[model samples]
Target chain A: MRSTLLIAWTVLIEAIRRREVYAIVVISTLLIGAVATTRFFELQGLGKFYREIALQIMTIATNLTVIIIASRQLPREFESRTIYPLLAKPVSRLSFMLGKLIGVMAAGTFCFLLFMLVFLAGCQYLKIFVSPPLFAQFLFLQILGLLVVATLSFMLSLMTNLDAAITLGSLFYLLSSIFLSALSYLYQFSDTAVKFILRVMVFSVPQMSLFDLSEKVVHQEVWPPVPAFVIGQLTAYSLAFSSLFFLVAFLLFRRRPL
Target chain B: MNNSSAPLIEVRNLVVEYASRGGAMRAVNDVSFTVLPGECIGFIGPNGAGKSTTMKVLLGFMFPKSGSVKLFNREPGATEARRRLGYLPEVTLYYPFMKAKELLFLYGGLQGMTRTQLKVRIPKLLEEVGLAGRGDTLLKNFSKGMQQRVGIAQAIIADPELLILDELSSGLDPVGRHDLRDVMLELKKAGRTIFFSSHELSEVETLCDRVIMINKGRVVLESPVAELMKPLNLFEIDFEQDGQPQTRSVSGAEKFNATLAEIISSGGRVIGTRTATRSLEDYFIEIIRGHEGSGR
Candidate 1:
């Protein structure tokens, strides 16, 4: 566990010192700032629109940052030959990889925290009524979803090159909701074998849409916070898929000759 | 620490392969050797002769197709085995964002050293490696030679009982190489077992108690460095040519005598004569060429 933390600390240090996350936060703040300051032609649902746009921007910026950083971690280590001296020590490969996963998550959390601060500042300027419960759920679920994306990115990085891994991870996040919705609709009309395949696909990949609560946060006045049972199921769903992806990555990496 | 008198490293029938368009290409073919405890063994081989591949398998970074490799008679990369080991890779780049001290701390921490231990050792280790008072400098600003010094520092930070160094003098300037030699000699006196490969045969000759030379993924020669250096000798004739000094070297007394007589007869004043010995470099080139010639 200590080895894992040390390795994770290195990754976090790289993210912090590189100053790339700060750039993401700055860009997000600008987008949120522009939207917050706009008149929107004196629309009636201006608060909801602002909330919707700000949360979406934060989600996109944070998730993409997580995916990109996670995808590059292993490939960069191998390419730069940095893994040589690192693996030469008394550390195990499993610990090294776990450290990387946790580090990437830590970086994502740091990025998310910055985005959250900017987002809240935007809301404050607009005097919007934000429900604490729904906002908390939204934040927690988004991090859980980032873990899923991070693990998938790690697996893809091991199986393929860096760019392809990043592109695939981001594209999957963008299209997973549509893919799941389409699978559900197509299962009703498909033949037996196709339906079985669709069912397998449904369970094979994470249902990212299940982790999103942004819409609830945006319309908090219309609905109460999610119950504990749903949160439990979502947590289990994230852990299951993340484990699958992380297991594949570890298997590929354990015996690879660097 | 594997302190018993057993071999520090043992390998037998080790075969490693890589997948290519030409089917499975073998990089190491039935190579075998053993390194005894407290012995400084030099693993010398031509490029692509499987030195790094063998080291990777010992570190468990690579899996063998068929063979047994053991450090301390345990499975390679067992935690107990690794804890007693320190390795310097043939080529590596430290994290550019990390300072020298920070990098050492990370490596030392992985070796189970606490912060207090690192704090006491890092400054002195840096000075020993010739990088005094530069611990806080980021690695990005360091030259390749300076980075190699940092590599040396990190490798010895934990003071392991066994050290595996690949390309021991790579990327180092003359001063860096000298400092490393001094450090390695100290480790040798301290009874640390070392297995390392280097293209610099002179460094091997100076530091290695025994040497295992390989070519084309096969062991060509394995012997004590003393045994090899004993029979190999060279003689030199120092003379003046055009009011300037010159030296001519030859392998045998017959050739040395002839050259000396010729210089004197041609009105070149002979200043002195001395006997020297053949170097590990000469022996390495000769063996490799002979091996290739036999193959042809």
Candidate 2:
């Protein structure tokens, strides 16, 4: 565990030096500024409009940053031959994978929190009111969603090249967010064989939309009447799927001829 | 276990293959060797001769398709086995953003060293490798030779029992190579088991107790350096009057002595007489040429 954390810390330090993180931050700030100056803000319910836009930007920034970082972590190491020295140590392949996962999570969480601070500052400038509990729950769920995406990206990276991993990771995120719920409706009307395939596909991909509480937070819904229970379930779901992806990645990585 | 009694490294019939467009390509074929404690073995081979591939298997960076490899009587990837081993790769690629001290600390931490240990050891190692005050500089700014120095430092920071260095003298200037030779000699005195691969046969001849030569993914020769350096059935005798040097191809020591006496008695004034011995480079080339001729 200590070795894993040491690798994670090293990776986190390396990630912070990457220009991509700064680029994302700058783009998020610019987008927030553009949205604040929009003529739509002059209309009524300005707070909801601003919150919705700000949350969307945060979601996109966090998810994109996670996918890019997680997807390229292992591939870059292998391309540069840095993995040789690291794996040549006393660290196990499983620990190496876990350390990478933790590093991606840490970096993604930091970026999300930074973007959230920017969004909150933008809200303050626009005189938008955000309930603390709703904002906290939304932040928690956003991080959970990012974890799922990062884990999927890591797994894809181990199985394929960088471009393919990132492409498949983005596709997975988009499909899970937009069409995962619609799978239930499609399944009800489908034939038996098609239904089985649909069920398998749905089960294989994570239901990322479940962790997207942006709509609820924008409208201040805080679903299920018990935010703590929802948080627990989301945590469990993320851990379960992340573990599966990490296991598969470990198996592939151990067999890889570095 | 008694460290002196046990072989530090043992490889048995190791076979490693890779997939090619045509078919499976064997990188290492049925190679076996052992290194006892306090012994320095030099692994020499031409390009693509599986020297690096075999080192990778021992370092656990790659798995063998068949056969067994053990370090310190444990599996290669076992934590206990690796803890006692240190490796310097052929190309040491470190993260460019990290400073030399940070890189050493990272590797040291992975080896389970504490903060205090690293604080004392990092500077000492950097100094030992001739990079004393450059620890705060980022690796990207360092030259290739400087980076190689850092690679050596990191490899020895933990004072491992077994040091596996690939192409140890690569990218070093003449002075740097001389310093590395001194360091290696010091390590050998400290009872460290050193198994290094190199194209510098002179350095190997100077430092190693045994030489293992590989060609086309197979071990063509393995012998003690003394035995390989033994004189063959040829002699060269030079006279004091600067006459033409005479060369003799004799079958036995008695014939060589008789020829020497005959030349001296004839008032030839024998200045110097020596038997012809083959250097490691010549032997290596001859073995490789034979393998190529056999088309194996």
Candidate 3:
């Protein structure tokens, strides 16, 4: 565990030093700043519009950053031959994979939180009321979604190059968000064979939409209180999906020739 | 810890294969050797000769297709075995963002060294590797030779019992190579086992107790340096030519004596006479060529 944390620490330091993280943060902040300073004071439902756009931007920035960084982790290490020295030590392959996952997740979470802070300050300045619990839940679910994305990115990275992995990760996220909701609508009219294929597809890809609560936070009139049972279900789903991808990545990495 | 009976590294009929477009290609084929404690063994081979592949198997970076390889009687990837071993790869690539001291501390920590131990040892190692007072410099600014020095420092940071280095003299000037040779000699004096692969046969001849030569993934010859350097049947006769001494090798003893007597009779002044011994380079070439000629 200590060795794992050491690797995690090293990776976090490396990620923090990268210019992309800072650039993403700066862009997110500027977007939020523009929204906060806009002349929407006399507009109806301005708070909802501001909340929706701000949360969407934050989500996109965080997810994009996470996917880019996670997909590049293993491929960069192998391409640069930096993995040689680390593996030459007494560290196990499993520990190394876990460390990378944890590090990327931690870095992603840090960036997400920073963006949230900026958004929240904007909300306060605009006199937009936000329930603290709902905001916290939004942050938690978004981070959980990012975790799923990160694990999938890592797994794809083990199988392909950095660019392909990143493209696949982006497509997965985009398709999951778009197609997951249509599964129920498509199920009613589909034949048995089509239904079976759709079922397989649904079961294979993570239901990332399940973790999205941005709409609820934006429109309080439509917001339903999330009970402990729903949170438990969401957490279990995220954990199961992340674990499956992480295990596949570990097996692939173990067999890799380094 | 002082037992001399057990070999520090042992391999038996090891084989490693990689998947190529032309089916599986063997990188190491039935190669076996041993390194006893405190013995400095030089692994000499031509390019694509499987030296690095064999070392990778021993270091757990690559697995063997068949047979066994062990360090300290434990599996190569076992923590106990890895704890006692240090490796410097042929191309040492480190994170360019890290400073020299930070890199050392990271490796030292992985070896389970305490903070206090690293605090003292990092500087001492930097100094020993000719990078004194430069520990705070980022690795990106370092030249290839300087990076090689840092590689050596990281390899020996934990004071490992067995040190495995690949091409240690690469990317170094004459003075740098001389300094490394001195450091390696010091490590040998401290009873550390060193097994390194190199194309530099002269360095091997000067530093190694024994040399193991491999060609085409097979062992060609393994002998003590002294035995390999023994004088052959040829003799060299040097005589004055254009105010300079020019030497020529005479194959047969009769021809050598006849040439010496002729030089004396002609008053050409025999500057020196000595038996000719094949250097490591010559023997390496001869063995490799012999294998090629045999259709291996």
What TM-score does each prediction get for chain A alone? 0.96, 0.92, 0.95
Error of 2 at B259 (Å): 8.2
lDDT of 2 by residue, B1-296 (tens): 13457898999999999899999899999999999998899999998999999999897777899999998898887889889988888877788889999999999999999999999999989988999899999888988888888888888889999999999998999988998999999999898989999999999999998999988888889999889888787877766543765555555788878987887787677767777888999998888877875542
DockQ of each: 0.71, 0.66, 0.67
Candidate No. with top TM-score: 3
**Order of models, best lDDT first:** 1, 3, 2
lDDT of each: 0.89, 0.86, 0.87
Tens-place lDDT digits, model 2, residues A54-78: 7888898789889998999999998
Clashing pairs in 1: none
lDDT digits (tens) for residues B127-237 of candidate 1: 999999999999999998888888888888889988999888899988888889999999999989989999888899999999998887778899999988885458878
Query: Which parts of model 1 are misplaced by more than 4 Å?
Result: A41-44, A191-193, B1-4, B231-270, B293-296
Candidate 2 accuracy as TM-score: 0.91
Q: What is the interface RMSD of each candidate, in Å?
A: 1.1, 1.1, 1.2
The sequence of per-residue lDDT tens digits that candidate 3 reaches over residues B1-296 is: 24456998999999999989999899889999999999999999989999988988888888899989989998887888888888888876677878899899888998889899999999999999999999999898899899999999988999999999988788988899999999999999999999999888899999999999989899889999999888888998889855777888899899999988887787777888899888999999888888885532
Provide candidate 2's TM-score on chain A.
0.92
Off by over 4 Å in 2: A181-196, A221-226, B1-4, B230-276
TM-score for candidate 3:
0.93
Colliding residue pairs in candidate 3: none
**Share of reference contacts found in each model:** 0.71, 0.80, 0.60
Poorly placed runs, candidate 3 (over 4 Å): A40-44, A221-225, B1-4, B233-235, B241-266, B273-275, B293-296
